[model samples]
Target: MADALTYGLGPDWEPGEDGLPFRRAARVVVLDDDDRLLLVRGHDAGEVTRSWWFTVGGGLDAGEDVRDGATREVFEETGLVVRPADLVGPVLTRSAVFDFARVTCRQDEEFFLARVPSGHDFSHDGWTDLERDVLDEMRWWDVDELAAAVAEGTVVYPETLPELVRALLDGWDGTTPHLDESSVLGPST
Candidate 1:
């Protein structure tokens, strides 16, 4: 198996002529059953950003397509293979994070949604090196759990995440209505 630490950032951090926000590249979100969202846990070297609760993805390789990167990262981080589906289109989300007490980072992230097959086991026999380590735990979280996490400021969902939830709800003809307001459901703002 290849070392997970061998991952690359692809592009170097270069200051723009005007010193504006730099693009952090794109990512993918894989939505599972029960309106539960899939998040990958990882360590951040920055002080204020010691840990991150976000989707499973990484910087796009040089000249690599976004879709390919999304698919590769998902499989690498969770052993869950997925194909990109429509949700909020290609959304460019610009946000700031305090990496350290003094260092600030503005990230421009591109977001996409992918559907995880029902009954897909992330701990299946096909997990990659990084997937096994980064995703030590995986569960189908309830809407309330997600809401609480968001409210308490624990997890950070991508900007297009809600839209993906809505899309899933719309396509799901199943019995239970797992997503509603105050969480992945409710309003799209």
Candidate 2:
């Protein structure tokens, strides 16, 4: 008989008090007109790792402020300039140990919500050193559609993102967001 799949799967639990059951990372969620969320499809490094449908954000650099990193990442990935807005909230999502193995180090990721002006153009060429792979395609969809995609694994955001979106929509008056340095993003991890 063939060995069970779990035979070589190793223990189901994580190790060390600091070694979390899941990997933590940061992201930025940008919603555009037509109510569709913007997502980037790219590589984390130079490898053919799993593709993700994520907001325009990425890992915080060593000693980098959260908001600067978020905006810089957005510009690098999408070429759209934006001001960091509200703190949608924080998310503590998990990932397999193997997924984070390639990362030089690990920490809990922080996220912030930024508003993209309707008239702002995203078609430009800008680059960041941390960019794993460049993603040119962008898409938008309704919240319900997004939720379905997330549930079906067709769309992926940070684990805490959906709830944050719901909260933003519930309280949003569509007014211009008040941008500030203190209101900006930085690593909370």
Candidate 3:
């Protein structure tokens, strides 16, 4: 549910697949000093049972730089202020289509990497109404826990997220991966 319309993005919409509104977003894959990754749990607004875990980020504003947008989104969603310079490579680029808040949307997203202190403070003080409706739980997950969750059928975006995290934890290779449509997890059930 990283679509712009689901999180207070501008009204500027680009038509996408089958005339669905399109948006551009900047997402952050946040890792803590302890090597745990921080993610947020989101439930489809129209169907709470349709849930998944994703990184900390959301739609960017028109003309907003990706790194700036990523840091801004982090503060808005987690109450932690991150500087743009602190953000690492927009390590991944992706296109995703899905249903959120009852509307199907297409989004182009750039994912960046961030490292924060363990147990960094998080607050919902800046959430938009739509965000409050969909994003609820936030947690730091270790690789094994994420693997176990996925093994149990928990839905996570970009299906190979665990592997990506594992690789990043081992050390970023400086290559920007393109997670094409094939990587998107599709519409919520």
Tell me which of candidates 2 and 3 scores higher on TM-score: 3
> Which regions in candidate 1 have their CA more than 4 angstroms from the true location?
1-24, 84-88, 95-103, 123-139, 157-168, 171-189
Clashing pairs in 1: 180-186, 181-186
Candidate 3 vs. true structure, TM-score = 0.88
RMSD of every candidate to native, in Å, equals: 9.0, 10.8, 3.6
- Candidates 1 and 3 compared: the better one by TM-score is 3
Top candidate when judged by lDDT against the true structure:
3
Sort order, lDDT high to low: 3, 2, 1
For model 1, residues 1-189, the per-residue Cα lDDT tens digits are: 222222221242334333422334456656665556776555433232344456666655557677776676667656775665543335334343324222233344555656555677664354444334444455555546665666766545453344445555445433322221222221010
Residues forming the 10-long window of minimal summed lDDT in candidate 3 = 1-10
Q: How many steric overlaps are in each model, in order?
A: 2, 7, 0
By TM-score, rank the candidates, best first: 3, 1, 2
Per-residue lDDT over 40-128 for candidate 2, one digit per residue giving the tens place of the 0 to 100 score: 65444424454556666655555667677777777776777765554444322323222322322223445566666564556435544
What's the TM-score of each model vs. the native?
A: 0.59, 0.58, 0.88
lDDT of 3 by residue, 50-166 (tens): 889888888777899889888999999999878999988878888887776666677888888888898677899988877777787999999789989999998887777899889
lDDT of 3 at 38: 91
What is residue 58's positional error in candidate 2, in angstroms?
Answer: 1.5
Model 1: lDDT equals 0.48
